[model samples]
Target chain A: MSERPAHGWQTVREEVLRRIAEKIWRPGDPIPNEADLAAELGCARATVNRALRSLSDDGLLDRRRKGGTRIARQPVGRATIEIPLIRTAIAERGARYGYRLIERQEAVAPGAVSAALGTAADAAFLHVVSLHLADEAPYALEDRWIVLGTVPEARDEGFEAISANEWLVRHLPFTRAESEFSAVPAAAARSGALDTAPGDALIVHRRRTWLGDKPITQVDMTFAPGHRIRTQQ
Target chain B: MSERPAHGWQTVREEVLRRIAEKIWRPGDPIPNEADLAAELGCARATVNRALRSLSDDGLLDRRRKGGTRIARQPVGRATIEIPLIRTAIAERGARYGYRLIERQEAVAPGAVSAALGTAADAAFLHVVSLHLADEAPYALEDRWIVLGTVPEARDEGFEAISANEWLVRHLPFTRAESEFSAVPAAAARSGALDTAPGDALIVHRRRTWLGDKPITQVDMTFAPGHRIRTQQ
Candidate 1:
């Protein structure tokens, strides 16, 4: 069995992960060197090295040039935040997704919005507000500002038929983005749109995206009370 | 310079990152193959391979057996969620951190909490409530349940001087954890402890951790209105 068939790097990665998960190798305990592990597992040394490097990237193991590799003593749960399309999110849950365009107009960028996008204070932008629903109930209220200077094509695509949220995600692929998660009391407008009483607590997701140095858009999504987001590695 | 001195893989990774950040290779554009990049950068092929593999894990590059490697068009910001100690978080922001124990008691685990921990309902747990303060202002309220079966040592840690939140982080090195983010209205008890009006919106972070198959602890942290969490890659 030592000279068994060749395997992919992913197979070696999963085996290493299983060993760590099973406590066969406890936290802070150094595992065998790459050459030794490769010999024992009947895999190439290069494959074993790749697997260990990947595990280290996930905060599962600590690797050093001279000290070798060991499991992390205190592993920070390294989760990937995949910003999904709103429609796709609802669809994955087997819920019927609904979208309605509330308002759209060309307006001067607000001070906060301008600061978020790193644009001039009073720069003109296309302001759009839309509501997303799951099963005909309010799920989230999106308020967005798209910089016309950065995305000129947005001017031609009037947002009356399609949401600026979906449109931007499809048309503009950003290189850099910043996002914040917070809670806020539902204001008058938010309450009306979300069908909730004013002053009710709501979770808010705010994001700003840029393509290289050009700021594309900034958006704030306010979810109805009891809305939750689960993330996993 | 074709035979440049040996360097660590991290050095090559950063150099590749700088080139991408500078837009020398635009998104959707393929850079040279591994052999070519190694030769041009005067590094070992294995070193270059490690750097490319790391970048691919980060969602910055797409690599395939036949496709070589190319910049990502729509990069999903891969962020590592480093669950920080609240005290450290407040101190990092240049604010004074304070902890107050609200209540402690032995009680049956709630149905939801029990299910989250994969334990049977009615299992006795050490329920602890506490408040975290930043510069004398209410910051977050924590509600936690420690599995007595898995963590009997917690019974001795009365949690008067040190918070259970901090204590668990120090004592427990969990191998598995799940977290959820949501918004909920501040109920009467939560409002009183958090110094917010009833029905006000609050951000809630819920987490359950396990050591191998044994459940360790589950915690819910509710932040005051306007509290924000920013995560980035």
Candidate 2:
């Protein structure tokens, strides 16, 4: 074994990936033990462990406490989707960002919305509807429901200058969140809000955030047709 | 400082996350240095560093080599999407999985397809169209283009019993991949394959895989309406 100093876990990870790509370590095959690999590569066993743990997180390897490590039989592809503020996203695309408040009121939460937030069906929520614009064109239509019990301050704010999305992000920090991505045909109201023809396909991102165990807010943002979220890995 | 033995970096991470969630460490504020935190928490500096690094990876903290770490001003919510084999996905939903080959041929790649694959527009590619089913109902429609040069064995394989998606996972490995999620109006052919009405909104997942710098395959999988990809964090 070459007596090279340990460069880092990242270097070890790249070497392992190269071996996998070259089929030197074939799929479903057991890899050398960490101590053996460390000795051969002139790296600490902890470095090998870290690299393997990271590969496991990426769904590329199976590392068991006692069963040893093996190449994943059916490696799954994992991609990270970063949900950013609409204004930030628009700015990143080099477009001018705009926001318009359509409606805001305290209304009874719908059954589905209530269920999503784990609240009573007849619970009152601060409902806010708004439109996000890019370069003076309709970009996304947002419909949001803020739990009044969790965010009583929202009841006083008019939400005219800043969107509920931006306001909540600025004021509240959530400990947990859930997101769902789907496609839906634009309804009449949604089409009008987005300046799209009725029945046009639209991408919808639905998110619910919570502080500890208490529900905070739920929002659905429907993007205009042809919007795509892309990621490279 | 607590004299307890370092439970692990994970425990330290949880404590840090609690501090952030409770606003003890406000957004955009510089966090305690690793050495200071380690001393206060009675852990190794490396443990504090690892915890901070993990938080940074989660987009909750911003770390700099010289400037130190700080709470992210605009913390981005990250969701990990796992793209599994269609059959496996169906099985996980407790449904019987089925697949039918719709079309298979060698065709000149379209301009958009070639651009996505980083190949010549007129390059010849093996094109395959198929439908996946769950519980005897249409699930997802898959359209794929495979580079013959990168996957020569595919030219010989019929892909009758197994899908190219599974076959490639078994035979080849990719070093890099890109995925795009979008909403599209189903064309006549796609609608027929998915058994949905024309103009129905479909969630389309497009992916391209590369082995090193050489392109391997590009595929588009369109899910039927009402299908959502959900993740929690």
Candidate 3:
């Protein structure tokens, strides 16, 4: 029987990575055109194009419309931060996950929250405050606003048993999102919820999700002191 | 006269994104197989495959080897953080960029630094501390260690005019890197350099880069208070 052909784009991508890692194609070196590379590797030109595009997205290669492809001279390291479900993140650490809803009510969104969601300052939203715990210790304090105009169901459903974070993931469809990462001193009110002292350094993660052009939710999560987001590329 | 063919992978990708955005392919819905999609779109099977794979990488689709592809029910929002050269970042902000070498000396690497670099505990490294300024205001304080065994040229040069951050990027070839983002209280020593009060919240970014298995350098950058990293997807 003939062996299965190993000409997939993934195999091509691996070969390209190997060449760069081994310095076979040194930095700033211009790689062969896709057509030439496909001919040499005995694969379709489309396969080579796909592999090169993937590598370029990863910041390993530079491809210009008319400049062909070259190994990146000063490769900007790209670290992909995948914001996981808070409960899943806790469970992944071999810790028991706990969540408690502190407050849920229809309230007018703050000016910043309104601006982030592209809603009016007087827009009423389903406001939710909750705490996520890992091993019964404070993990993250979540403050969320759901645009009632886009998600009318949120106003009726009480988020007492389930967090809006998890509920929205199951109920809504997100097509786009924006996130901001910063450091902030914990306010007195939030510090009590997170079980940290006031003025303690905290990692603040603010995120907004959209379904098409309609805003779904805007959330700010303040992690307990010493929380870190780590990634490798 | 025939018009140019519009059957590329990019066209397929755009169509897929549109369907998802329009809720035509709702979350958790299984998408058509590659062969069927290719026939329907009048494109090659490889083009459909490439488009689907790209979407899967972006966390929009979940493709199982035996189960086929489906729209992700709980799509993980991926934020790509590109760590740019400090000078370039400042210039992009429309600020005058400035750099100052606080200290540069050959010293024994600290235990934590050596461990991070995968070097000996007693390894001697080029220790460099520098301050990056935007519009004459301190932006970030950088503490870096260069592995002498892998980058011996760093030991001969004094980083007085150009920062080690810029020098390494121009001289080295990076195959892989790891980054960590955390919140920390500014220490007294660093607080002075950043012109911030002690115990202020700061965004601490730690990065280690490698050429294959060999470590090139490890650096810790502590940004001034209120600095935020933002990204959209």
Candidate 4:
């Protein structure tokens, strides 16, 4: 089925893949052309194209420029990345989830923080230091700064009762954000955050969220060594 | 607009973010709820939800329970993991893309490969080791094993001209896939895959793609110490 249709790419791909997998089109065997499949399925050629395109991307078929499509000789690995909530991810894995407000204070925005918050450098900002836990073990250290100019109500919204994630979900109203994932060798402070050895490689997720036409928050989320975020495509 | 809409989430998000950048909703300003947004945009609520949910996730709005949503005090960093061709990623970064044909043997699958390929444990399999280069720099060392029993035709397919990634995309007919992302300290032989310093964090992508119920490929893609993949939500 098309994304526009009830049966999306997953459904059609399943049907086609089952045929090939069952040796309906054994390796080296040519599969039906897109036109034929489109007509057979009462769908457009584009729908078939999407299915084939994804299958090819996943390394299941042999599609060449004008050579047509065939079953792959050997399937290649297909991997997907999943984004997860930090707290649940830790807890589900049988780890304790804890948060510590290391630094929470009212301050003036620095140039960089101001730029990130889309506020003037002199704007009031809330700087909060937080440590995250997994199974009572130190997992991540977060150095988060909130724009007090933008969140006056946040001045007294103690983070002790709930987690920043849950609080943000409830009070923060930005409709857009960006997440950057990277790996870096650990520095001392970072090592302290994760209870890691010196020079440990850390998986870093730096996230920024924005209100409509306004800058709001910047969070630096650094994970302990061996931490992973799973995702699918 | 929807997935079928001219602008996908990416395009819409950028536009909306720009509006917010322009201060349509300044920091701490309350924005309309999603329902009102859907109405104003004349699009599906789901689309609005996707956009809004992403925004909330990014920490732009201070979302509350019936208290309404507002801009964050400080904007979060935009964390984007760029999903590019592995080859392109290395090449663009001025490293040589390298490959090595580890073992070109046709044999029955091993335990895990068998289960993944949906074939007998002894299903014909092709094992190869290839290294990815970035401008003559070692970026990734791949230990790839393919099960030919499920897709036997790859037995004679020459993998010389193209990278496994490119070759696989051109060939294969898979329907569903699952992948896992992890960060692990380098294993023994792996330490030499990309000439990494021992104990550096290596980002590992473990994946298994399926054709219908038939397992097709199981692969482990290990990045060098500094490789990063970015995705925006």
Angstrom error at residue A174, model 1:
1.1
When 1 and 4 are scored with lDDT, the better candidate is 1
Stretches of candidate 3 above 4 Å error?
A1-71, B1-26, B29-71
Candidate 4: segments with Cα more than 4 A from true spot: A1-15, A18-84, A90-96, A107-124, A186-188, A198-200, B1-83, B90-123, B186-188
Model 2 lDDT tens row, B84-127? 88889999999999988888899888888889889888877999
TM-score of model number 1: 0.77
Q: What's each prediction's TM-score?
A: 0.77, 0.80, 0.79, 0.66
Candidate closer to the true structure by DockQ (higher is better), 3 or 4:
3
Q: In order, what lDDT does every prediction score? A: 0.78, 0.84, 0.84, 0.67
For residues A108-192, what per-residue lDDT tens digits would candidate 1 score against the true structure? 9879889878899878799889998899999888999999887767778877767787777545556567888887777635457
Q: Candidate 4 lDDT, tens digit per residue, B1-233?
A: 22665545554566567656555666677777778877777766777768766777766656888778776665223333444457766667676666665445665556876665567766666766677776666777666667675667677776766666555544555566566566666544555767777656777776666656656677777887776665454
Off by over 4 Å in 1: A2-77, B1-80
Single out the weakest 10-residue window by summed lDDT for candidate 3 chain A: A1-10
Best by TM-score: 2
- Give fnat, all candidates: 0.48, 0.69, 0.71, 0.40
Query: Between 2 and 4, whose lDDT is larger?
Result: 2
Highest DockQ: which candidate?
2
Provide the lDDT at B57 for model 3: 72
Q: Which candidate, 2 or 3, has the higher DockQ?
A: 2
DockQ, computed on Cα atoms, for candidate 2: 0.44
Candidate 1: residue A60 Cα off by (Å): 5.4
Judge candidate 2 at residue B215 and give its lDDT: 87
